[model samples]
Target chain A: MRTILFLLQKEFIQIFRNKTMLPIIFIMPLVQMLVLVFAANLEMKNIKMKLVDFDNTATSQEIVSKFKASPFYNIIGYSYSVEEAQNSLIDNSADLVMVIPPNLEQDILNGQSPKVQLLIDAINGMTAGLINSYSSMIMLDVNKDIAIELMKFSANQQLKQISIKQRFWYNSGLNYKHYMVPGIIVILVTIIGMFLTALNIVSEKEFGTIEQINVTPIRKYQFILGKLIPFLLVGLFDFALGLFIGKLLFGVPIRGSLFLLFSFAFLYLVLVLGIGLLLSIISDTQQQVMFLTFFITLVFVLMSGLFTPIETMPLWAQRVNIINPFAYFMKVNRMILLKGSGFFDLIREFLYIGIYGIISIVVAIRLYRKTS
Target chain B: MKALEVSHIYKTYNDITALKDVSFNVAEGELFGLIGPDGAGKTSLIRIIITLLLADSGEIHLLGKDVVKEYKYLRSRIGYMPGRFSLYSDLTVLENLNFFATVFGTSIEANYNLIKNIYSQIEMFKDRKAGDLSGGMKQKLGLSCALIHKPEVLFLDEPTTGVDAVSRKEFWEMLQELKQKGITIIVSTPYMDEAEMCDRVALLQKGEIMSIDTPQNIINEFSEELIEIKTPDLYEVKEKLRLEFGKNSAFMFGQSIHFSTSSKSKSKELLNEFFEENNFNIESVNIIEPNIEDCFIKLMTKDS
Candidate 1:
């Protein structure tokens, strides 16, 4: 235990003495959090729309006015021809186009339903889908107003209709930043925990200091635990800072118990740092460790459902994520912060990560040999 | 009991043999040297004995403990300074020293007297980072760190390989002081002249031990008469002499040529007559004593 304390003292001195690495540890996470949360947004607004009205009648004009009043649509201009409206879409100036046919009022007065054609740019499938839904909702509102007016004129007192209402439960406003900040915090914690520990031991190998330590009386478990504790503290500190930034800058809610969140974060960091130690043991150079960690963390972060929902991914990808610790952390982070999930709700993730941490550390220590 | 004992040690990397059937013993309190050039298996032998590397097939007993089986207990009883500068360069000198002392589960105050002779030289620069120190100072710090634990045996691999001439001499003097304290020291060096400082040395070459004995005894064992000849055209004269006396007989030593002959009498006269026939400008010729390097070359040539 005294030997481990000495090792920790040495490691901390080396870590803090590195002037270049200080900023990378403390400031890079803040910059990433402030930038990625806002930049990675998928919410659609101000969709550029083009209106084509063949019937220059009052009803068609009223419909065009209704679209103009909506906040989601930005009408660039009116086109007299359908082909001209399509040219706007092809030129990338318009995201959506609505065509009101001629005799649209005559068909309505004759109790015949008319068709309104919508020409939407389907290049980006998600944005095109949003535009289609928004335009359809506006058209439905116009139909309702027309139906009520016609019912009053015909003295039909009994008209039956089924109306559906939606209320988003957790994220009422559907703010993308709220959903992204917690996930980005997972990434921040992972980078600090994994990359630093991975590079630390490999640098010692490159410098030949590890050989000196290996020849000492220190046991393998003592040496490995000595390396683990300092970085674990640093990882937790980075996690706290990330949480503070998430709450301050993005107004990300922390509805769950802070104690439970931190306890789980501690476990998650151990798993990450354990893997880092394992990589360092197998690699001889800092460059090799860096490449290996980078490749692995890249795969984990992408499959982590940070940018895309894991449920919507292919079945094989979802299966692969069962072993991805980042995915577990990302899900738990969102659950605790946004959904206020309790400890019992995240019991499975806790058990898997804890088991993974213990196994990786054991394997790392077992694979580390004092002799070469 | 012997401080270190090895019998028929062998080690190989892939298809290349590093140490082949090598064996040596160091008595307690003896200052021993493994003298050889680079790639001569000096480091390999030292590493195997120190428990930092495994031998292919051999038995090594350090302080009567099996090196492979009792490595964990033996580690605390031995100190090693590898060929490279292995101290933490980013750490201050005192911090590096203190850290190693703590790692060995001892305090500097407890072992302060052991490293005082060496550590006091750089005591004023204790606050300076090790990486910012000179090469000689870095080596001194490494020695101090190794000695901080007061191990029974100390292994130094090429400690003076890159040090300055003055620092190299000082390093040897320090080793002598440590030897007086009765700690067995096994140091490896490529410098043949450094062998004279050791109580005993094993001249190693191509993964084999050429000879093992005291420096004086090894020098006295040279049975052939050696003649040194100086000429203006040294290379030309050397090549001519090689053709006449065979390749292993004549070699360039410094600015002159050393020619060895098994013919005891009138060898110098024969060499003078040969130089005269070749129209060589010979300054002079005289019988000279053989040094360790000469003995090594003779053994190497004889073996090949």
Candidate 2:
């Protein structure tokens, strides 16, 4: 343990003394948290919708007004013909074209359901799907109004109609930034833990200092632990800074216990640090470590449900995410911060991350040879 | 017991052989030197003995323990300075020294007597970054760090390769002081003059040992008489002499030709007659004693 303390002291001195790396370590995460939270938003807003009302009726105008009032749609233009609306959509002026039938009010008054055609631009498939669902909700509300009026006139007070109401439990306002801040914070911690440890060891190799250390009586496990503990501390520090920024800038509430969040972060950092050390052990130069870390981190980040939901991904992608530690942490961060999840609720994630940390560290130890 | 013992050690990298059936031994408190040129397996041999590298097949015992099996125990007792400047360049001199001492489970205070002579030279600038120090200062720091643990044996690989001549002299003086403290030092260098500083030297070449003995003994073992011939055109004199006495005996040595032959009297008589007949202006011709460089050249040429 004394030997480990010495090694850790050396590592910290080297890390802080490096002029180029000091700013990167202390300030890069804050910049990423501030910028990425705004850029990585998933909420679909200001969807441009064009109206092609052929009926010129009260019901059609009411539906159009509802869409315009919901804050989700921007009425770009009103077209007299379906062809004109199609032109507007083709010119990128509108994303949704709503064509109401000529007898929309007449059909409703005669107690017959009317048909409406919605021409949606599916270029962004996810956004198109959302627009479709929102437009259908507005039409359903108009139908409910007609049905209630008809039921009162017919004196059918016992008529039954089923209506579904939605209540967003955790994020009532559906703010994308609130959900994204915690996930981005997870990414920041991951980048710091993995990149720094890998570069640290590889730089030692480049400078040929490992040979001097290798010849000493320091045990391999002791050396590995010494390297891991310093970076783990740095990672936790970065995580705390990210959380502070998340709360200060975005006003993201931490509903869960702070202690629970930190303990889980500690476990997750061990996993990331193990991965970084393994990468360093396999690489011979700092440049190789940098490139490999970049490629692997990119893969983990893109597939870790940081921006998209893993459940909606293909089966193959979801299967690959099982080994992605970032995916597990991203999920747990949201669960704990947004849903007030407790320790027992994250037992499975803790188990997987712990096992991964153990396995990666074991492989790193096995591959790191004292003799060459 | 011998401080270091190796028999029939061999090492290879890929298809290239680095150390071939090599063997040597150093007695306790002896200053041993492995003298050879670059790529002559000097660094490889030193690394293998220090347990930083593995020998393909061999036996190595240091301080009466197997180097491979008891490496952990041996490591605490041996100090190694690799061929390159391996200390952290960004760290201060004192920090680097303190780190190595602490890792060895010892304190700088414990080993102060051993490294004081060397460390005191650079102690004033102990706060300077190691990379910012001069080449000589860096070597001093390297030596100080290596000796910080007060190991039983010190392995320095080419400690003076790029150092200035004055610094090199000072470094050997420091080593001599350490020898007085009964610390066995094994140093390797390509500079042939350093062989004379060691009690015994092993001359290595192309993964093979050319000779292992005291520098004076190696010089005394030269069987041929060495003749130094100077002339206006040394290259021409060399070619003519090679023609007369064959290529094995004649070599160029800085504006003079060293011609060796079995019969000195006959060679002298022939050199004067041959130069006169060839219309060459002879400057001086005398018999000179051979040094380690001459011995190594002879040994390498003989082996080839």
Instruction: Name the best candidate (by TM-score).
Output: 1
Please provide, for model 2 over B1-304, each residue's C-alpha lDDT reduced to its tens digit, 9 standing for 90 to 100.
8999989999999999999999999999999999888999999999889888889999999999999899989999998888789999999999999999998888899989889888998999999999999989999999999999998999999999999999999999999999999999999999988999999999899899989999999999987778898887888878888788777678888888898876656677777888888889889989788887788788888856
User: What's model 1's TM-score?
Assistant: 0.95
Provide the DockQ value for model 1: 0.84
Output the lDDT of residue A291, model 1. 98
Model 1 agreement with the true structure over B90-149: per-residue lDDT tens digits: 999999999999989898999999999999999999999999999999999999999999
Model 2 scores a C-alpha lDDT of: 0.90
> Which window of 10 residues has the lowest lDDT sum in candidate 1 chain A?
A151-160
Candidate 2 lDDT over A1-372, as tens digits, reads 888888888888888988977897789888998789988767778999888898987878887788888888899888888998998889998899988889988988886888989999999888898898888888788777777878888896956877688999889988888899999999899999999999999988999999999999889999999999999998999999999999999988899999989998999998999999999999999999999999999999999998789999999999999999999999999999999999999999999998998898899999999898
Q: Model 1: per-residue lDDT, tens digit, A142-249?
A: 999888867876887856799899998778998889899989999999989999999999998999999999899999989899999999999999999999999998
Which one wins on DockQ?
1
Compared with the true structure, all predictions reach lDDT values of 0.92, 0.90
